[model samples]
Target chain A: MTSSSRIQRRAFLGRAGGVVAGGAAMGARLAVPVATAEESAGPAATRKSVAIIPPVAAVAQPVREALAASYQIRMLDPFVRFDQSLEEWAAGRRAMGDSLRGCDAIVYAPEPAPDRDEASLDELTRGTYDLLNVAASQKVQLVVFLSTLELMADYPKEFEVDEGFMPTTDTSVRRMSLYLAEFACREFAREGKLRCITLRIGQLANASATPASAGPLSVSPGEVARAVKAAVDVGFSQPSRLANWEIFHIQSSHSQARSSTEKAILQLGWKPDQD
Target chain B: MKVLILGANGYMGPHVVRKLAPAHQLRITDIRPAPEEIVNEFPKQEFMDVDVTSVEQVRSAARGMDAIINLSVVRQDPILAFHVNTLGCLHVMRTAVEFGIRRVINTGPHFAVAGPSYEQMDYRISPDIPPHPGIGLYPLSKSLGQEICRTYANQHDIQVLELLFYSLRDRHELEPGTGGVPFLIEWEDAAEAFRLALEVDSKELPSRCEVFFVFGDIPQMKFSNKKAKELLGFKPRQDVSAPWKRG
Candidate 1:
């Protein structure tokens, strides 16, 4: 972190640049046209660059496609293997810092294997912090952290949650890790140099799968992609609110009464395209 | 003024003792008994053995002090680290409030904010950077200690000044660097920072809980001490290498 007085305009540009032309057009009925470099020259850079960490997860495919269609995309593999030593972790952080340069935004989705041991989970936690430090160093405008909504798995059958709901009593490792990630992001975001958006996603269905008839809450990969787009768009359009730090619950509209997507809709101007 | 120094046997404690002994009535306590040399030298000052981890001992040691400076820490033992670093801080703060000690100085390493993993070594760090997760046990516990300070300062009628120190070394020592980390401060400069922190008027400080980075003037500095300079009148009298230039 630089002196507060010397924090560069790139920090402001990263957060407020998108709002110059697109502020008034954002809301429930947003129509974002694919902007070209020439069209977005003044304050709005048409070709913004996004770096996605651990880029190959199945849930990220739609997000990658959506971002690629609109912005230049950089895929970063933050090598956070379970077996790496502290030295290797530092080396990886240095490498990630190199990749973060010139990027306007970053999407971090570290998909640890389900059967990963405690050591692997610890590494994943460190990796996430390393990524944040690199992004903060580069002063990336927006960071979309993809976290699981499984933290709320113990909620009663019809319980609905919003961004304001607290998970004080939960002690599960998955839940605690997500909470820690959010806390770490808040540390950077509170400084106003960077904007952090946490999307606590529900169970991810196949990109092409239809809505389940009934059972558990799940969202298709494409819907997840749309949620990511909405988060980025909101970050750009509403610099005052979303540009600081905001978390939203994301699920397909079809998921019956298990989780609430109201905050996502009202806050980020996002609604699942599929019912 | 009466000042209580916790963890008075650490590396930087003697320097602080030397600086403050001339003006203030000092009471120095640590888990280890105060050395006979310090006791003989500062005959007017009081020295005792008190474990900061014990709330009763810390409270008893803090009874008559106008202010408290907590320097006690455990770096290696994971369980003792939290007990002494985090919970001990809680004890200190609670004792301060009970004793009507309005001004408190909490000492921690730069790792409390910049993290020990060397992840943010490339960037210039100020007190504002959030504590990176997985900074291992020592720094994590110290960071938690800071949070405790913040909580007490906000909820109670006490003012807390947290001074985050970087490499405490002598002027002639080769700059400390294991893997590209560039921040360092001389022992004298760090002790001076503590003295200045103690001397700064409450009116000059902006909030009840404030943090400042204390390090020497190194070129292309990795950690900025501007806040310390501006608010606490900190002036580094030592020069260290610019890590970026060395490589």
Candidate 2:
């Protein structure tokens, strides 16, 4: 058996645009032209409704307050608690849909919590999809997902870690749960369901609490808020051909920072004015 | 070696059990209890009702087992799809680590790796390609589950082999052409890969995690079965390509 017969290269493109666009949404959502809101354009055309999803209500306050300063920040009250029974989840799904309607963008920060067990983490990962489904159905313009810098924590303190650097292999239910949530969001973006930007923020502590884990890369809590706002307004960076899925690593400036924050500053036009 | 089959109530699980029963002791589990025939056949054997979504139950199932084969999955129902197919893998891997189990055989459909995207380009398709599960629930959920198993295998001392099948046919009937699933595998041929995966030496695998596209040879050979053949020494006893031949 000659190698030529065993492997023959055919002369066909096999149809361009092979079926990846209309993911899980099935058929219709692809045809419905999604609404696009200008990135914080002119004089207050009724401030674009930007919803903040902080997993538990306690995950992000500074980020919420910062976003609230500029846009209409809608906090999903009670949150989508999937730990509840199936009956509750049925109602919760509907409630989550109700919460996301008419939003221009969403900032999903499913950060870790000390009290969250493995089951709750699983719930949070799935709940993220439910939230994005509603957001996509409503034709929400953009989603700024707040992932963590800790996921890629294996590199040296002096290493120049970019957004493209593969994350750590940590399979703890907590870390893997967050990574899986990001994976789902990427498919939605790749399918053009909605414009999504994942901001992997560095370790941060609010006004007077000790940092969660000691690290050379201590980000100011306020920088995280600014990154979220800038991500919402980054539409100005590219008007005609904005990428469907983009990732930016934002961290405070340090003499010995672990990961580089150059992309966030250049693309989102972010600032590093330490509070 | 003792084997534990999680989600063993499905159509394929019984065939796998039938093949392994004589040589290996088995424990089977699923959301529903085993079928009556299996209960009667494997009388006095332990059959636990396990919901793969529950970590507690998954952990309990892995205890005292040498190897685990996960056949559980949910194709539709958006909510339950991710919970059962995606998180189910996480629960199983977590249990494997807790119980110090060394090997796991995870199963999913070929579409999980070769979705509508890959289907469009039809030649020499293999499981080595990056998974573009598209947006379908079954593919997306199972692909994510594979990712979890891959991560677990890379991080820990467990060896994970993922078997991706397209369609399984009856040997006697020998249906040809890509009717339902584009690729076809004889039922016995598909079930036999599990035994090869279980018995293969850990040193033979190129990495901690390996994915195999399990199917028999076809005339067009749109999908390649070479990887499974070379790695696990899988041979399709049934002549799958014969029906495609013209007299």
Q: How accurate locally, in lDDT, is each candidate?
A: 0.68, 0.73
Per-residue lDDT of candidate 1, residues B127-229 (tens digit): 8765652345567668767766776787787889999885777665644452244567778888988889898998998899899988877766567889999
Give every candidate's TM-score on chain A: 0.75, 0.75
Sliding window of 10 residues with minimal summed lDDT for model 1 chain A: A16-25
DockQ for all models? 0.03, 0.45
Question: What is residue A220's positional error in candidate 1, in angstroms?
Answer: 27
Q: In candidate 2, how many Å is residue B200 off? A: 0.5
Q: For each prediction, how big is the interface RMSD? A: 8.7, 1.7
Which TM-score does chain B of candidate 1 obtain? 0.92
Poorest stretch of ten by lDDT in candidate 2 chain B:
B173-182
Misplaced by over 4 Å in model 2 are A1-46, A55-59, A77-79, A208-214, A236-241, B121-123, B176-178, B219-222, B241-247
Q: Residue-pair clashes per candidate, as listed?
A: 0, 1
Determine the C-alpha RMSD for candidate 1 after optimal superposition of all C-alphas: 15.2
